[model samples]
Target: MLTDVLKPEKTTRKNAKPIWLMRAGAASELETSVQDWVDASAFKAGAGTVLVVPDRKPGGIAGAVLGLGDGDDPFVSGALASKLPAGDWFFDSPSTADIRLASLGFLMGAYRFARYRKFPEERPSLILDGSLDRSELVALAEAVWLARDLVNTPANDLGPDGIEAAARLVAKDRKMSVRVVKGGELQKKNFPLIHAVGQASQSAPRLIDMRWGRRGAPRLTLVGKGVSFDSGGLDIKPASGMRNMKKDMGGAANILALARLVIDARLDVRLRVLIPAVENAISGSAFRPGDIYRSRKGLTVEIGNTDAEGRLVLADAIALADEEKPDMILDMATLTGAARVALGPDVPPFFTTDDAFADSLSAASLIEHDPVWRLPLWAPYLRGLSSGVADLCNVTTDGFAGSVTAALFLQQFVTGAKSWAHFDIFAWNPVAKPHAPVGGEAHAIRAIFAALRQRYGVTRN
Candidate 1:
């Protein structure tokens, strides 16, 4: 639980510390004494900078002033989780800041992937003064932490089997039903593309299908490309490119995280999470680059590059999800390095034909502070994936608009869903930030959740 770092204020402590959060312009408006102290100490109110004030009574500590810079950064308070002194603390003036966002920032900032650590690190705690919904904040933080944990775990401990275990854990908590289609079962179940990708690995590839919520509720299907570890199969990736292949399954981790949020909130929607879990390992049995395989959707896909296995697995899962003709279908994948090259690691690029949906996602991205940029499913790029031997090639040969081509390839498998959106995400944060540490980060899930809430007219408490 996030209670270790974020807790509701039940009773006041006699010596509770105060944290005075301030923007640069507001510093001058502080009480005369406080302003004088800040000026004398050369505190410029730069973002994330802190200055501890001494109490009037000797040997006691007064409130602390934290810089908010221009007050534009929603996650400015995140830095305080690591910077503040130990003990209970609360916002000096609750109305001066968005308490919910601040608390979330602090909780996320306090997160550490200490599962395998010999010595755990201590994190500063914040006392919520009932200004925010405790359950909602905790649920969101836990969901994000869950994604980080799944992505940070090595492939040795988190392969196709491990991915299934994680989904089962979430299902067990929610009393949801889970079905696994594995090994020869995948072939019999018509998940040929998914099975083909994992045929080389000793661990059987499987489709983890989890369902929750009332049967008659509106259907929302989520598909994630769960390439447990992408060794690029027979094509193989360069050693440098394969260093962090464990995170190739980041898409599955994220969907599971999003599912947790939806289930914990008990959203008024029937949710189906489809994860095509596999490892694109190389061996004599590995699917070859020249091979053509029939997909679950019945499209014969020519293998343009065996390394482009994420879209193949996702194609099968997306087809399965679309078969139900859900109200909406959303799929996420760390499928293309081209996406990372186009948007960098921080901004994930989304693809959808629905203009209004794109606009809503854009609005949610800004409001949720979980940024995502929309990239076109350019029809012109469809020719790039043309194959003479089959319905289409798995990838483009020219290497232009690689991300767009990948999205277009997946689009071919979806014929039932009313609306579809594909998120090509670099789920790993490459650098440390105020609210995000340099490890597996949950990209775009929060924004998508916010959009879902608005669409369903569900309000957070």
Candidate 2:
């Protein structure tokens, strides 16, 4: 259950009602009454105008209006959650409006990473009118919350085992079945790359598998990189580079969050989630930079740089996902610094060979307001990953197109999926935004969810 904030002094309609409104370009006929009230009333707040208005219509009660001073900023619609009075309120408008994205955004925007500290005050609540499906909205919010919570938890408590445990807990909560292949089990499962990277850690390495939805539905496979903490293994990172390595597994957190949404929405698809959980820690037994390992896909990879271990683990997980020959495969990872360099921290870069799939995802981002940009899976970049003695190298020899090369490496492992998409997300908001506090964030999950919903339609709980 989510927390709500409501003041006793605030005026309410017939039922202690709460709703969110958008102030657009010039007041329309629909908003004429509200606009007149705002012009007449004097409020102290500047940007986010939260006030209860009188609604004397037949079944209507008091309504809440959120101020978007300038109509130019599109992100303002979702940022209203931070300013409104705290309470579990629903939207006052009809559900026919395409505002599910804003509903999810409101929940995500109001989110604060509070494990390290307490919030100064309660956040506002949101309620949607009878139009949109409540369960789908809640599922989307919960999934994003899970991603933020797992990524925000300090590395000390969220190591490899802890990550696996979190996935299991979510599986149990959703009444889904899960299987964990850990430590020696990796050898049995034939996921050598996943085991090699995690063997050096005391926490042990694990591959988390979760299944949900009807058995006969279309299969949709999701793989996430779960390097809980990256000390850069034997290669070692500079102090600055290592500072936020705890968020290295942010890819895994985001995927699990998306998985939660899929199950909660009950989408008409057979969902499979694979998270290769590991910690790239330094130790005497840690896999060395020159080591060569066989992947589950049967391709041999030479470790050019230990820091490029996220793809290695994901390679095995993707191979496993491919074996199912799913309709689509989506893998998320905080895999490359180059992606951040190209798009900065907020917009993640995704790669896919299927044109229709790419368009669907791109359009869904615009509709959902959880934007992700597309980067080509340039076939020419395949040469950058060539190895003298192995099928490929984990990194590029000249250090160019790091994100592209990383995507190319993972592509080698995907064989049977009809369509595949890879996301290189920063997954952390360095600075605070209205809905997102400065901490681990779920960058592309919402966009992907929107695409899924469009493809398969929403499934209610």
List lDDT for all candidates, in order: 0.86, 0.81
Question: Residue-pair clashes per candidate, as listed?
Answer: 0, 11
Residue 317 of model 1 has an lDDT of: 93
Which candidate has the top score in lDDT? 1
lDDT of 1 by residue, 1-461 (tens): 46667645585645677777778876255667777788899898888787878778986667678788885776877788778876777776646346667777877887788778743346567887666677877888898999999999999999999999999998986878999999999999899999999999999999999998887878999988888899888787899999998999999999999988888877888889999999999888899988999998988999988999999999999999999999899999998989988999999999987778788889988877889999988898899888999999998888898898999999998898888999999889888877778899899999998888767654232
Model 1 misplaced stretches (Cα beyond 4 Å): 8-14, 25-27, 57-59, 94-97, 118-121, 458-461
Over the stretch 1-461, how does candidate 2's per-residue lDDT look in tens digits? 34442222233444545454555454433367776666677532233456666778874545676554554333454566666545456555554543565566576677766677777676666555445666666666777778889998878999988998898888886778898998999989799999999999999999999998888888999899999899899899999999988899999999999988787777888899999999998888899988999889999999999999999999999999999899999999999999999999999999997788788889988776787999978889899888899988899989788899899888988889998999999989899766678888888887898788778875443
Structural similarity to truth (TM-score) of each candidate: 0.95, 0.87
Q: RMSD to the native, candidate 2?
A: 4.4
